[model samples]
Target: MQITASTVSLTVDDVAASQRFFTTHLGYAEQAAAEGFASLARDDVAMDIVLLARGTEVLPADQRDQHACGLILAFTTTGIEHEEKRLRAEGVEITMPLREEPWGERLFQVTDPNGVIVQFVEWATPPAAENA
Candidate 1:
């Protein structure tokens, strides 16, 4: 079995604010927007989010929190230092500094306004082979 694509959607108080944050900082393009819903995309990936207006259908935040629903979206880049510097220069908060892990990967993490963590990773390279 195989999965084609994955998407994570969440509720936000302000659609425009969330949309702006994702589009401006994370490079997600605005795909669609309405009074109560909005979508953002990066390349072929997309997320559709909805604003919870007052209604009986709206579940409480605590109930939603009970489920294992938080997600950490990751983006791989060749220029990890450049991306880290760019995000730092723009005043984005870094949850984890760039560091090598025991699992053999260099990575860092940041949390956006909606409490979603975004990870940036740059894999280590193997040494070049010596010509015989």
Candidate 2:
């Protein structure tokens, strides 16, 4: 099957708060929105996002009461330091400071209003060549 689009639906306690975070900070445009739901998209990214209130009936009966937790929504990006600085200037709290991993992955993380962990990552160096 050919997939045309991708979206991550998050059940949040405050849909408006999540909506504002995505649109204001992350550059996502509001595609659609209702009382307790919002659809957001970014032209540069293929993935879209949908926010639903925790108790919204549009969700499955068993999932309606559940909220998004233990999830880290990450984006691989360039200019991570600049992005981090810009976010800081905008009053966005950095939950994790920028750091580099032994394998050359550089990253930082921020927690959204609803506790969604958003991480930005960049490769510090080219992948090591395999030794035959």
Candidate 3:
């Protein structure tokens, strides 16, 4: 089998809010939308997003009321600092400040209106792997 794309479905308290946040901040365009659901995609990238209102009937009963807690939607891209600065200039709060890890991963985070943590990461040069 072959996989053509990937999508993250988030159950949020407010579908419209998350829809607006992604479209306005992340350049996602709406592929489809309904009363309590939205499918988003970006032309320049393969990232697809689906936002569902909490308690939406499309979800199974046991999971319908659950929110996207402790889930981080991350993207690995170049120009980490520039993106951070650009987002800041757009008035988007940086929930987690940018920092580089010892292993060469530069990253930062921002939260959506529904509390979904979106992280942007840029990997630096890799050091040699140590022997076991």
Best by TM-score: 2
Number of clashes recorded per candidate = 0, 0, 0
Candidate 1 accuracy as TM-score: 0.69
Please list the residue runs of candidate 2 whose C-alpha ends up more than 4 Å from where it truly belongs after superposition: 128-132
Candidate with better lDDT, 1 vs 2 = 2
lDDT of 1 at 27: 79
Q: Rank the candidates by lDDT, best first.
A: 3, 2, 1
Against the reference, the lDDT scores of all candidates come to 0.66, 0.91, 0.92
Alpha-carbon runs more than 4 Å astray in model 1 = 1-5, 44-69, 126-132
Better candidate by TM-score, 2 or 3: 2
lDDT of 1 by residue, 1-132 (tens): 898656666665555666777788877877677674666767754443343322213457554433213676677666887888888888897889998877557889887665667789877762232222
Q: Least lDDT summed over 10 consecutive residues: which range in candidate 3?
A: 123-132
On residues 3-65, what C-alpha lDDT tens digit does candidate 2 reach at each position?
888999999999899899988998999999999999999998647999999988888899999
TM per prediction: 0.69, 0.93, 0.92
Clashing pairs in 3: none
Per-model C-alpha RMSD: 5.0, 2.0, 2.8
TM-score of 3: 0.92
